[model samples]
Target chain A: MSSTLLRTVPALRGALRASGAPKAAGAMASTSFVRGKATLPDLPYDYGALEPHISGKIMELHHAKHHQTYVNGLNSALQTIGEAESKGDFTKAATVAPLLNFHGGGHINHSLFWENLAPASGEGGGEPDGALKKAIDSDFGSFDTFRAQMNTALAGIQGSGWAWLVKDKAAGTLGLVTRANQDPVSGPYVPLLGIDAWEHAYYLQYENRKAEYFDAIWNVVNWKTVAGRFEKT
Target chain B: MVNIGSLWQYLALHSTLSGDSTNTNNTANNLAKMGLAAYTLPALPYAYDALEPHISAQIMELHHARHHQAYVTNLNKALESHVAAVAAGDVAAQIALQQVVKFNGGGHINHSLFWKNLAPAGSEDASVAQAKGLVAEIEKTWGSFDGFKTAFSAALMGIQGSGWGWLVKEAGNGAGLRIVTTKDQDPVVGGDVPVFGVDMWEHAYYLQYLNGKAAYVENIWNVINWRTAEERFAGRSEEKTEL
Candidate 1:
């Protein structure tokens, strides 16, 4: 299914260039009447919890402003996509394509990012136990090697993208892939975990060098949450 | 008889001599490569203030000092305890600590990649070039040079969130090269060598693009150090088959 994008094999390279301008989410919303959508979900821990790794300033801004922007933008996009679908203008829906992708992506990314982080207490951020540990060892050879690969690839992302640990059902193995823009994995793969690499996600604290942020992000990754994800899948 | 560090150094020295000077220097690479005693935070490549308006000095300040530092410190602590357990033969503690190793250690590894990824924005173009062999390979991998780029951009723009667009080799698999996308902390495939990658993480481009990641991805192509990638690819091939 993921290969379907490739299957069409249109002159996709140059065939899909936009006018190089985005219709503002606000502008898109001005035309719609979707009652301004859901608010940013409350982060479980206080903004200060991930401090030092993530600054209080950055946390406050990221959750309040940045995440909020995504929430607002996502609602706007969904409403626009809805309207476009109703008008039977798939092309018009496509015009707001970047916004839909961006805002929708932000909403999804932050939601996961927030849920995946927690305090390093007994109740949260606990180290992987039982099956998760076994899986890490078996799959990546050793946890150290697994961490090395993940961190390197995660840090290696170019612009605004995500690092994901997805389960490829066909491969029947935990697969790792980074998607640029807000593109998530599809079909057989389910997102076991995700890390947000958007500047707004960490720039206030991490600055131009995202590696700092990426490094720090591990401190708060809620492995128990991952364990739970593993249980369900 | 050789430790992983020396093993890597010997390989890297050979690579550098053969001209892949872009390889990482003698920093403690990862938790496994260096025992707990050896790990410390890596120093930054460029000055904190280098990226400037493209990225603020203030942001770099905190990002490096506080954020990256935490990863280094915690990774060391996590490994030290793990190693102690390992030496004492406490398999459970050692096993459990692997999670910490990945969480903190991965952070350090990823950050190191980020530091090397950027340059002074506009002037980054000077560093862009690849060796002749790699250029032929690029031509072979995805048709013409422009074809490779268009495909790469499409992959990049198609991405969903906080991820990466990578042009990577399939390890020792001689099936030529492939385009890959990795989620957080996912390594390049098995032994696949990563020659060039673009961080689509927001911090890499947010100051300029806002949510317009496509703009950021397109703009950075001008700054791509193709020369660096060329050398890396050449070095990988050379290391495997020595003169």
Candidate 2:
């Protein structure tokens, strides 16, 4: 009984404290009220790690400058929405939706894209094995076929966008999906691997020869990470 | 039975509601300012195949028909919703709709001008002599026509993303020429007159030029409508670009 009382005392005290607190204070103090700011994730490898295939210069600018802008934009949009909603300015909150969608999707896509790449010398490239290979073969006929299809999708994108290898949730089958601009992969599809086709992705090294960049990217694809995501999904 | 005082009060109220104090006597202009007027896609001055060889027929068709048409359709839709939102005092919807209006509206305005700014590769209007007044101004500003071309081409090449490079005449009396660039579909705003602009968006040259932007830039001068440039420079163009 004494041990039980000891455990119950803290719970009782917490309940009393919560009840006695002012409504605003209680809302503020809730753990759920804390908002996490989106941040630029640290690159897993050195900027120059994917060298020859993708230059160190491009990696530095893309990761440090481009990705950071998205992170900042996402945070700003979130903060604006929160403040607008607090003040009952629903219009202002709604106004921020596009920015939030754009910057938020950019942050999410870049984070996933960074993790999807690895140095060619290490655990990067090569064909997937185990269940991943089976699924790819079953869905796309062969590994080469799957690659060609992804590359074709990448080439078909008219403007800034990404071509993703996605798995339909209900169907559990692999598919190729393309998104315009920074639109995130959502609604029943799980993005397994994404290749950014924005001009900024390869303009410095490849310029107008985007097909070469597409072919070269396959050499540095981190299939291990893709396999992990596939199995988890 | 209305008194003179009441008549004045009603007119004042009407003007305030119409949101056109400056154009109270003009009903059409008032309707336009109040977002009641819808934007339409301006037809290309020349045929789709007119600017071929330099800019392909395929590119011109796609750029004008599909892309510019989408902007016009979306802009009209956004403006209609904005009008309703304003009437209903839905500030959130109005704010949310601002960027779409700006982007699509600018696209319409820019493309409308771009069509008029181009002539056939060897047409009379394409000759530099048609813009003798503007040519002299360009010479004064950048030393020579080649000097100006070199400078403008550099600006176009320097753009990192989709944008436009323009030759604008400064606002006010005795305005001077300036080279400027705007990102995406942003139009030349404020007091300056955009004499001419070059679309640096990848879609503008990607299909034909295919990463050879320098070649496209060098070739564009052959089709430039110097006549239109002269009209815009002299501030006497009949092109109704008031968006």
Each candidate's TM vs. the true structure? 0.48, 0.52
lDDT of 1 by residue, A1-233 (tens): 11233235555523433432245334434533335565566677777887677777677777887778777877878788889999999999998878877777777777777777876543444357788778877788876676678788787564457888766676657767887756655678777778876667766555656677776677777888887877677
Best by DockQ: 1
* lDDT (CA) per prediction: 0.64, 0.82
Query: What TM-score does chain A reach in every model?
Result: 0.77, 0.85
Q: Against the native chain B, what TM-score does each candidate's chain B reach?
A: 0.67, 0.84
Model 2, residue A168: displacement in angstroms?
24
- Give the interface RMSD of each candidate: 6.6, 7.8
